[model samples]
Target: MVRVATLLLLRHGRTTANADGGLAGRQPVELDETGRAQATAVGERLRSVPLAAVVTSPLIRCRQTLDLALPQAEPVVAEGLIECGYGSWEGQPLKKLAKEPLWPVVQQHPSAAVFPEGESMAAMSARAVAAVRAWDARITAEHGPEAVWLACSHGDVIKAIVADALGVHLDLFQRIVVDPASVTAIRYTPLRPFLVRLNDTGGDLSGLVPPPRKRRRRAARTTDSDAAVGGGAGAAR
Candidate 1:
C-alpha cells in the first residue's frame, strides 16, 4: 500500500502589523495579545492529533505561534518557508500600498508580480512548496504514513502551499482566504494530494485519528467425520 502523510498548515496568530494592516514582510514581529489567545485556542483544538513534528518559519512571529500551539514538539526551522520579503514596502500600511500601480498585479496576477527590491511571488511559491514536500517526506519516513505534522508559517506562505496542493494558479491565490491562526490540512498520498480541510478555525479533528487495526479471522478446523465425507465426495467425483 502507498503511504500517506497528513500536513497541517497553520498561519501564525495576529501580530501588531496584522492588526494595523501593515506589511510585516520578513520583519521580526511578535504576536499580539489577541494573537496569543488565538494560538492557545488552536493548540487546544489540535491536542488530540498525534503530531510527529512541528515545522515553522525562522521568523519570530511563526516561532511564537509554534511555541504557543505545539509547545511540546521541537520545531524545525525552515528558512524556505519564511514569509515573502516586501523590501521597501516592509512595515508599510496596506492602505498606502493599495494606491501603488503594482498592487493590482499582486492581487490579480501574483505569478507575474515581483516585490520592489524583494523576492518574486513565483520564487516564494517554489521555495515554500519545496520545503513542505521535503518535510512531508521526512516525517512520513521517520514516523510512517499515518504520521501527521504541523507547519506554522505566515499567511502568504501558507496560501502558496495550499494553492500548489489545489493545483490553483498563482494568479488566483488571493481568492483563497487564510485568516490568522487558521488551520488547513493536506493529505499527501502516492496517487494524488487531497485537500482535507482549509481555513478551519474551530471544529473537532477526531476524524483525523487513525482507524483501529482490523484483526484477521482464523479458519475453523474440520472434524474427522466432516473430513471423511469431503474425501469420499472428492473420490466419487
Candidate 2:
C-alpha cells in the first residue's frame, strides 16, 4: 500500500497575549478562560476521530490546550514545534511592534525578518515544516497509511507550516490567519500534499473521517491525493 498520512495542525488556544494584542513568543503563557472554553469545544469536535499520535509544542499554552482537548491521549512535546523565539519582541503589543522598522519587513517579507536575540522567520518555517513532516512520516509508518495525527502549536508557526504546504512563500505567510484552536488538515502522498482543510474553527470535522472500507476501496481507483476536478463532490455526506 502506498504510504500516506493526514496531519492535523491545531493552533493552541488563546492566551492573555492573544487577547491583549501582545506577542507571547516563547513565554509560558497559560490559556485564558475563553481559551480554555475553545479547547473544550475543539475537543468535542475531535472526539470522534481516531488519532495515531498527538504532538505538541513545548509552550505551556499548547500543552494546556492539548490537555483539555485530548485528555486521554499522551502528547509528545517537540521543541521544533515551539513558538518562534520572538526575543525582545516577546510580550510587546502588536500596535507598538507595528511601528518598528522590522515590523514592515515582517509583514511584507517575513523570510527576511529576524527576531532580535531570537530566531528568524525563515528558520522558524524550516524547522516547523521539518518537524511536522517527520512526525507524519513516522506516524504513517507505524500506524499504516491510514494514520491521522495532530500537532498543536503556536499561531505564527502553524501559519508558516501551512504556507510551506500550500507552496506559498514565507513572505506571504502573514496572509494566512490561523485562529486560536482552529484545525487545518493536510494529507501527504508520495506525489504531493493536499490541503484538505484550512483554518477550520467551526469544529465540523466530519469530512476527515474515512469512508466505509468498501467505499474507500472503490475510491482508491483514483488516488485521494489528486485534486478532484470541478471541486469533486466533496467528502461523502
Candidate 3:
C-alpha cells in the first residue's frame, strides 16, 4: 500500500483586508463578521472528518479560522506556515501596486521572487517545504496508516505548500486558486504526491463545489488581490 499523506489546506475567513483592498498580512486581525460565517461554514464541513493533526499559522486570522473550523481541534504552530510579508506593501492596495510591473513578476515567480522589505520567493518555498516534510515524517512515524495532516493557513502559504508537494515551480500557483475559507486536499504517497482536490468551497470538499451563484462584477483594478498575496512571505518578523 502506498504511504498516504493527505494535506487539507484551509484559507482563513474574510477580513476588512480582503474586502477593502488592504494588506492584512501579520496584522493580527481576527475573523470579521462575514469571516466568522465563512469559518463556521468551513467548520461544519470539516466537523466530522477524522483529522490526525492540525497545522496552522500563528497569525490571528489563520489561528481564528482554525479555531472555528476545528472547534474541538488542536493545532501545532508552524511559523513556516505563516502568511507572506509584503514589507512596505503590507497595507497597500493591490490596485496601486498594479501600476508597477514588478507586481506581476512577484505573482508569477512567487517561489523565487518577493517585494521589497520582504522575504524572497525561494525562501518562502524552502520554509514551506521544510514544514511539510517535517509534518510528513512525524505523521509517518506516529501513525501507521490512514492518517491525514490538516493545515490551516493563508492562501499563499497553502499555494506554496501545494507547489512543494508536487515538486513544481511558482507557475503552478496560477493553476491553484484558493479562496477564503476554501479547502484544497492533496493525497500523498510515500513515493510521490497527487492532487486530490483544488480550490473549493464546501463543494470541493466532495468534488461538488457549486457553480458561481451569479455573474459578479469584478474590480478591474484588483484582479489578483487575494490571489496575489501581499503578506505571508517571511516568518513572523
Candidate 4:
C-alpha cells in the first residue's frame, strides 16, 4: 500500500437553506450566489495546490462547492463521502420536530433517535468511516508513497468521520463544530490517523504542504439521489 502526502477535507459552500438555517439533510440545495463566491475564493486560495483527486459527496451543494473550489481539478463522487441522511427529517424543520417530548432523548441517544422514523447517528457514522477508509486505501495505492486528496463533504458526516478516526465516543457528537467551507486536515499513517489540523478555514495551513506541482484532472458531476447506505457492518443503515 502507498502512503498519502496529505488529506484535506472541505465542507461544501453555503446553500439557500444554509442561509435560512434549515437542517438540509438530503435537501439537495445548490450554492446561492454568495456561496458560489465563497467557493470561488476557496478555489483561488487553493488554486496553486495540487490534488491527485477531488472526492465529493453526491449532493448538489457539495458538488457546486467542489466545482467552485477546484475550478481546474474535476471531482469524483463517492457515495461513502455523501452527507448523512436525515431520513424523516430530510425536508422538515427541526424547530418544530424538537417539540416531540423525545427530542432530548433523541439528542442524547442519537443512535436510537430514529429521526422520527429516519436513520440514526450510529448508522450515519459507520458508512462515513467506510468511505474515508476506502479513499485512504486508494490514496495509498494510486498516489504512490506521497499522494494528496481532498474530500468535500458535510458537517455531520465529516464530524462522524473525525470522531471515528480519532476513536471519540459516538454519543458526544458536538465535540467539533465544523463551519461551512472550513478546511480540516487529518493525516493517516498506514496504522492510525493523526489529525494534523482542525477548523483551519482562517487561512492557516502552517504544517501543511500543497501539491508539489500544478496539475489538473477531469471533473465529476453532481447528483440528487436520495438513497443511503448503512455505512458499515457494525450499524444498521
Candidates in descending lDDT order: 2, 1, 4, 3
Local distance difference test scores for all models? 0.85, 0.88, 0.72, 0.72
Model 3 ranges off by over 4 Å: 204-237
TM-score of each candidate structure, all chains considered together: 0.88, 0.94, 0.80, 0.81
Task: Tell me the deviation in Å of residue 109 in model 1.
Answer: 0.6
TM-score of 3: 0.80
| Predicted structure with the largest lDDT when compared to the true one | 2
Stretches of candidate 2 above 4 Å error?
A: 1-3, 212-221
List runs of model 4 lying over 4 Å from the truth: 1-3, 210-237
Report the lDDT tens digits of candidate 1 across residue range 135-191. 999888999877888898888888898899888898889989899999999877664
Model 2 residue 26 CA deviation (Å) reads: 0.3
Per-residue CA lDDT of candidate 4, range 1-237, in tens? 223556788988888888876778887788888888888877766764567778888989998898778867788888887777666766656787677775786567666655556677778889888887778777768875356678999998888877876778777766777778888877666556766667666673433653334333445221112112553232112
lDDT of 1 at 31: 96
Candidate 2 per-residue lDDT, tens place, 177-211, comes to 99999999998777778888999998579678656
Instruction: Pick the TM-score winner.
Output: 2
Note each model's CA RMSD in angstroms. Answer: 11.8, 2.1, 13.5, 11.7
